[model samples]
Target: MDFMIAAAIAALLNIGLLGTIIVIYVQNTRLVQSYFTYGLITVASAFMVQNIVIVIFWFNLYTAGPAIKTIVDAAAPYLFVINLAQTVGLAVMVWINT
Candidate 1:
């Protein structure tokens, strides 16, 4: 159950990050070249969303009793895996960009 929940959360997180970029691009008024200008902002926005969510969940667990945190605890492992994947993905993107 925990694994499943984590998987779902991770999946949602991945979709959400990508969706942010896509939505920004779609709504952008400038030419494609403007993407270069937005590049840093886009990456910052994505990272901010990811970290803010992790911090919120981590804080929730820390502040809540175990009984209340039981469900979220189960999802921790999956979140860990996804977090590692996301970190690696960001690393790769940075490498490629540089």
Candidate 2:
């Protein structure tokens, strides 16, 4: 349960970070009209969608009752780490862009 909460938080953080990247990329794309900027926007958009899905999945698991929770517990730490890593990576990207 704790791990799930952590994972969810990390996922949410990732979504926020990705949103920042996407906005920056969109602004740059508008100013520069470069293919690389367009690609960055596309990739960031895709990552945002992925983080959204991860959050949704966490919510579903939270409401799934005890049976599924045991399974989720086993996987929660991995999910948390994965999401945290993504958040860190995205944060760095945002930092570099800014």
Candidate 3:
């Protein structure tokens, strides 16, 4: 698979993980009314937004000129790894929160 494709998949997964985390954190905040939980929800939400932006950027890059595409292609693998790592970390957070 193309590196961009892989990166996109990882980003999608990260988004899902962040969504799950946000849901859980929201529930926790409602129950405990703790500022810390609210902060967690905010951070997870920010991460989710970042992932959404990354996915949109990747989709736009698909139609970019060859020069830009080439540069993005070079960076895609690193991006994928970062996304994948975030996914794992978020998954762990979800697991812990539950």
Tell me the tens digit of each residue's lDDT in model 3 across 4-98: 89989889988888888888888888889988988998898999899999999888887788878888988888998898888889889989988
C-alpha RMSD for every candidate: 8.0, 1.1, 1.1
* Sliding window of 10 residues with minimal summed lDDT for model 2: 54-63
Question: Ranking by lDDT, best first?
Answer: 2, 3, 1
Candidate 3 backbone clash number? 0
**Model 2 C-alpha lDDT per residue in residues 5-81, reported as the tens digit of each score:** 89999988988898999999988987999889999999999999998998898789878999998898999999999
- In order, what lDDT does every prediction score? 0.60, 0.90, 0.88
Superposed by TM-score, candidate 3 places the C-alpha of residue 50 at a distance from the truth, in angstroms, of 0.3
Clashes in each model (backbone N, CA, C under 3 Å)? Answer: 0, 0, 0
Q: lDDT winner among the candidates?
A: 2
Candidate 1 residue lDDT tens string, 7-87: 445545555555554455445525455766487556756675766677576666745886867767776776768765875
Query: Which of candidates 1 and 2 reaches a greater lDDT?
Result: 2
Model 2 ranges with Cα > 4 A deviation: none
> How displaced is residue 16 in candidate 2, in Å?
0.8
C-alpha-based local distance difference test score of model 1: 0.60
* Candidate 3 residue runs with Cα over 4 Å from true position: none
User: Of the pair 1 and 3, which is ahead by TM-score?
Assistant: 3
